[model samples]
Target: MDLTVTDLACARGGVTVLERVNFRLAAGAALILRGPNGIGKTTLLRTVAGLQPAVAGDVSMAPESVAYAAHADGLKATLTVAENLAFWAAIYGTDEVSRAMERMNLAALADRQAQNLSAGQKRRLGLARLLVTGRPLWVLDEPTVSLDVASVALFGTVVREHLASGGSALMATHIDLGLAEAEVLDLTPCRARSPASAGPGTDDDPFAGVTA
Candidate 1:
């Protein structure tokens, strides 16, 4: 599936942080979001993933087509690695649990509980969830956090495979994942004017666009 965002606006803490954002991610492609810290990359991703509403504009895609992985690992600490993937597989109605584990290099750790894994292992497990999601679009935020160089390279390979199979990805990361074909969208040009800088007649509505 393809993702098309047009004239998008995103907010953080009830304030508009990005506006006029536009991008088109075709099937079998990837888009990398780049900007300084706290520049609304996460907010934009959340909006695209349907975790939060956009302040304005539209994201065109099929419903339930997106698989989002945020900063949080979103794991069940007591669940074994295999069990965690199984849980998500059930949610997405997919039967790719074992394949997911192998893709993330967690096959050997399948019986290990999430809490017992190292930070990088936990990250791998979290990313492995995307494989079982059976969704065409992946929206990831700092997906390589806590991952070593080898793990990062592994993830890059996984993403490439995803794209090869006609999947699309949108991610925000500082480290290069070596995806030379991926397009980059820098959010700096899309940054919204702060409320303090707004012209007269603009309302200072602190509650506007507040995301839960």
Candidate 2:
């Protein structure tokens, strides 16, 4: 599945954060977004994931073809590693928990409660959900958070395998994970130039304020 974003715009609190964002990710490839904090990297990812609407332009991709993983590991602390994967697999209508665990090197901790796992372990578990999603496109926000060096390497390998299998990914991260080949998009240039003091829709504003 390929992703195409044309003249896209993103906003927070009705204020445009990034504008004219555009990119195309072919299948079996990855696009890494790089920028400073609060630069709308996550916002763009969310818009592409269909979790939120694009403030303008177009995001061309089937919603169901995307699997999104946010910064927070949305895991059930009480559930075991295997159990957590199992739940997501059920929702995704796939029985690939065992393979997902193996792919992320979580087989050894399958029975451990999610809450007991260290930060790195938990992050891996969160990533494992992508495997069971059966979706071709992954939109990840800071997927490397809490991951150790080795775990980051493991994640790169997993991503490579996914691409080899005709999948794609869009990731926002500050560190390089040694991907085989990935296009890097710097969001700094995409930052909206309007000053904060300007009210929405006041002038060339996408979120211009309403008036009588």
Candidate 3:
């Protein structure tokens, strides 16, 4: 399951955040996106997820082949970790949800409600949803934000397994989780020129109303 982004461009509030981004990621590899704030790292992830409008390019990916984890955990406050994973598993048709939870070090908190868990715990659970999707391409935004060192290691292990099994990941993170042989697609170079204002189409734009 390889990912190809050709002439990919995204606009937020009539401003182009990224453009001419051509890259292809093969299965069993990872690409890390690095850049400072307001540079569209998260926006890139959203574009891959088909959440934002690709103003002038093509993001061609099978709907069911892409999985995305955002900065905001999608966990239900009243739901237990097991319940949340179970729900996603049913949707994705993955009975391996328990296995994913175990790999993420979430088995211990499986029965505990998400609201009672620490920030790091919730983040881990939120990330574990990726496994449930059974998708080959993973797009993550600030995945390591609230993770502890131990949990971070667990996450790395999960990612390694994903790659080993012919899965690919595109991650937006400021911290180093020691992903093996990851390629960096720095957005810094593309930022030398400011984004021009543009109209939004049917792509992923979280800041549709925010001015550039």
Candidate 4:
């Protein structure tokens, strides 16, 4: 699916954080959102994912066609790794847990309870749910939070495969995931500027209205 954002604005706690956010991502591509902490990268991803109403403008995509993975793992501690993925797959009306397990290298840990896994293992399991959702457009917020080097490589491979198969992704990350071709959007300029420096409604983010 082609995802488009038009004159987008976002807020957290009723305070606008970003404005004039615009971008378009076609199938088989990826876009990386970069910025310092608390600059509304997560807020922008949430808006695109439709978790909340956009403060202004439009995000054009069917909410059902988007799969979002937020900062937290969102795993059930008592459930086994496979069980967690299975639960999400069922919710997405899919049953392809086996391949997702293999992709995330969770085959051996399938029966292990989520609570028993280490942090990195838990992160992989959390990301495994993305594959199970089978959605065309993935909106991921810091998808690689606790992953090790090799595991991060694995994530890059998975994302590359997703793009190769005509899927698209929007991700916010502090560290490099080694996605070379993805367009980078620095959100620094998009942050709300101080009233003293700029008038009201100026995009506060430093990267506002810009893409690279």
Error of 1 at 162 (Å): 0.0
Better of 1 and 2 by TM-score: 1
How does each model score on TM-score?
0.91, 0.89, 0.87, 0.92
Q: Which residue pairs collide in model 3, if any? A: 14-198, 51-204, 52-203, 52-204, 52-205, 53-203, 53-204
lDDT against true structure, model 3: 0.80
Clash pairs for candidate 2: 200-208, 200-209, 201-207, 201-208
The C-alpha RMSD in Å for every predicted model, in order, reads 5.1, 5.5, 6.6, 2.6
| Candidate 2: Cα lDDT at 208 | 30
lDDT: which candidate is best?
Answer: 1
User: Best candidate per TM-score, number?
Assistant: 4
Error of 3 at 120 (Å): 0.8
- Lowest summed lDDT over 10 consecutive residues: which window, candidate 1? 203-212
Better of 2 and 4 by lDDT: 4
Residue 149 in candidate 4 has what lDDT?
90
- lDDT by residue (1-212, candidate 1, tens digit) is 87888878989899888987877889998899888999899999999999889999899998899999988999999999999999999999999999999999999999999999999999999999999999999999999999999999999999999999999999999888888998888788677877677667544544222221
Counted clashes in each candidate structure = 0, 4, 7, 16
Model 1, residue 95: distance off in Å is 0.7
Give the per-residue lDDT digits (tens) of candidate 2, residues 128-151. 999999999999998989998989
Each prediction's whole-model lDDT (CA): 0.89, 0.86, 0.80, 0.88
Question: Model 4 Cα RMSD, Å?
Answer: 2.6
Deviation from native of the Cα of residue 20 in model 2, angstroms: 0.7
Give the TM-score (vs. native) of candidate 1: 0.91
